[model samples]
Target: MAKYELNTKEQHFATTRLEAEAIVTEAKEDKHLIMHKIAEKHNKYGEYFLVDLTFSYNTPKEIMGVE
Candidate 1:
């Protein structure tokens, strides 16, 4: 069986490629969020394989004002 792993600040795993892709697509829809697919690898653990997908993004910062 092959598993797909999506990495950002945290890790997410999906059993199918479509599921993995869906996660990325949803993330992209956020207008304030910037995301990139940094790396991808296959056959991570021999028989227990994985398609590892790594992503990089900017974390949103909030500004505060004091009167």
Candidate 2:
């Protein structure tokens, strides 16, 4: 199985690519996160690779300083 890493406002990991994709999609819809970057690194055989996704959550400064 392949390992998936999602680096959003927080970091998350998945055991499969589909799960990682789903997590990003859900975050996009529910949290309004933007996709910043995606990368995959393969092993020697190229049979498995680690997927990394970076998501950015853009919140206004006004919304962050106060509760």
Candidate 3:
């Protein structure tokens, strides 16, 4: 195996994985409900890092309860 030295962005992205492309397609049809269910599942199963980062970046005000 080759050695690797990942930078910060690579490290963060490396920790995120989407298990199934189908789930993404499903979310495309019903974004609100499917994404909520996915978030809950990731939280419960301890794979919430990516979703957390995405929401934190994309919805900082909403997540942080700011105005």
Among all candidates shown, the one with the greatest lDDT: 2
Question: 1-67, model 3: which lDDT tens digit per residue?
Answer: 5333221111121224463334444444632332322233344546533232111122444534643
TM per candidate comes to 0.40, 0.41, 0.20
Steric clash pairs (candidate 1): none
Give lDDT tens digits, candidate 1, residues 1-67.
5333323543456556666677677766755344434233457553221333345433223112211
**Poorly placed runs, candidate 1 (over 4 Å):** 1-8, 38-67
Tell me how far the alpha carbon of residue 50 in candidate 2 is from the true structure, in angstroms, after superposition.
7.4
What CA root-mean-square deviation does each model show from the true structure? 10.9, 9.7, 16.0
Worst 10 contiguous positions by lDDT, candidate 3: 5-14
Question: What would the per-residue lDDT of candidate 2 be over residues 1-67, giving only the tens digit for each residue?
Answer: 5333333555565556776677666666655355433345456655332334446444455345654
Candidate with the larger TM-score of 2 and 3: 2
Ranked by lDDT, the better of candidates 2 and 3 is 2
Worst 10 residues of 2 by lDDT: 47-56
In model 3, what is the error at residue 11, expressed in angstroms? 19
